[model samples]
Target: MDRKKIVEIISNHYSPLTPECKLDLITNSKLLVLQKGTVLVRGGQFSDKTFFIVNGCARAYYLKDGKDISDWFAFENEFISSINSFFLNIPSPHFIELIEDSVLLEISRGNIEILSNTYHDFERLSKVVAIKTMLKQQERITSMQFHSAEEKYKNLLSIHPDINQRIPLTHIASYINITLETLSRIRKRLTRI
Candidate 1:
């Protein structure tokens, strides 16, 4: 994965970085190529790093009654991390896995702190990312509480049109809190209408 391209993508979403900050990220962060099914963060593991996906996709999940419940997905040009654990400096309850073969730029918490201290733009970018992440989570929770299964599916497609093509139906069903059969029916109904 091209470090410059990855930096550019993140910068587009967050803020423009100085040449020095960009260079620091490129040098301090490690590029990782993960195979599909690779677990980057395991439940109960202390996670100190955040992944910036340069290619492919990943999912964060939790185990509930022996079943994996997918919480969220991160694709290319997005960030993935055990937010609770990373911020609190504790073991994580969520597991992060690569759903497709992925390339990521891994930045440790220490390095992130260093960047935040050294660059004002980096701090602003971090705040923006945190706020965006929280807002997305809140939106998902609100959708589940207020929307029907079909409405949820339609809204998801409206926001992320390529999700059905990229992610497995079962995982999407799990994320939306619907059964696979129900999701299939919804898809069929959507096609006809």
Candidate 2:
């Protein structure tokens, strides 16, 4: 991605970066082109890196008794990281997997800290990112805890209307905490209504 594209993405979510901050990011960040099924961080691994998805999507999932349960999905122009592991310096309970061929900007915590300390605006940028991440997590947890499987799927569609076009039904079923057969039934029922 060029500087202009980076600028546009940053500007879309947060405020436009200052010239120095932009230069620092352009110099420090690495563009990662990863194919589907690429696992960035596995369970029990410590991930100090955070990925900004410029294109495509990634899913955070947990492997429990050999069954993979989807935790969350990050789409284009969103950030994906092993949140607790990245901040707590501990092993991650979830694995971050690229679900599609992705273009990502990878930034290490070291670089983030450097930028946060050197530039005031970078701190603001970090705050904005943190807030957004927290809000997303909050919503996901709330849905998983309180919503029915059908309601969860409906909420997912409301949030990302085109998600079904990009993601597989199995992953969606896992994310919404339903069996694939149940999800199929739910979809059919919704279509009828």
Candidate 3:
């Protein structure tokens, strides 16, 4: 993987990085190509690494009563990390798994902290990303709290337009807090309209 290309992609998705900041980030991170079903972080594990998806997608999910419930998804140019573990130094409550074979840029929290302190551009970029993540989480919480099943599905679709093509129905159902059967019925009903 080309480090410069990776940095360019990151800059395009988030804030533009100063040349020095970009160079330091390139030096501190790693480019990886991982296969599908790879588990980056597991429940109860300490997760210090955050991955920027260069290609493909991933999800953060929890196992509840032996069922997998997806809480978040990240695709190309997006970042995925066990937020609690990464920020609070606590064990992760969910698993982060790749949904497809993926190319990723991996960065450690320690390096992120160092870079953020050393570079104003990196600090600003970090703030922008964090705010975006926080807002997305807030939106999801509001949707889950108030939206009907169909509304939730539509909202998710609006955010990730190609989600149905890329993600499994079961995972989508779990993310939307609906059963697979109900999601299928909703899809069918929507198609008929």
| Model 1 per-residue lDDT tens digits across residues 63-174 | 9899989999988777889998999999999999999999999999999999999999888888888887898889999999999999899889998899988889999999
Question: Regarding lDDT, does 1 or 2 come out ahead?
Answer: 1
Give the poorly placed runs of model 1, Cα more than 4 Å off: none
Quote the positional error of residue 137 for candidate 3 in Å. Answer: 0.7
Sort by TM-score, best first: what order? 3, 1, 2
Model 3 bad stretches (over 4 Å): none
Q: In model 1, what are the clashing residue pairs, if there are any?
A: none
Question: Model 3: per-residue lDDT, tens digit, 32-127?
Answer: 999999999999999999999999999999999999999999998899999999999999999999999999999999999999999998999999
Q: Using TM-score as the measure, which candidate wins?
A: 3
Position 48, candidate 3: lDDT: 97
Candidate 2 per-residue C-alpha lDDT over 1-193 given as tens digits, one digit per residue, 9 for 90 to 100: 7745774687668756788888898788888899998999999999999999888999999999999899889998889999999999999999999989998889999999999999888888888988999999899899999999999999999999999988899999998889999999999999999
Q: Tell me the TM-score of each prediction against the true structure.
A: 0.96, 0.95, 0.97
Model 2 per-residue lDDT at 16: 63
| Candidate with better TM-score, 1 vs 2 | 1
Deviating ranges (above 4 Å) for candidate 2: none
Q: Can you list the residue pairs that collide in candidate 3?
A: none
Using lDDT, rank the candidates from best to worst.
3, 1, 2
lDDT of 1 at 85: 92
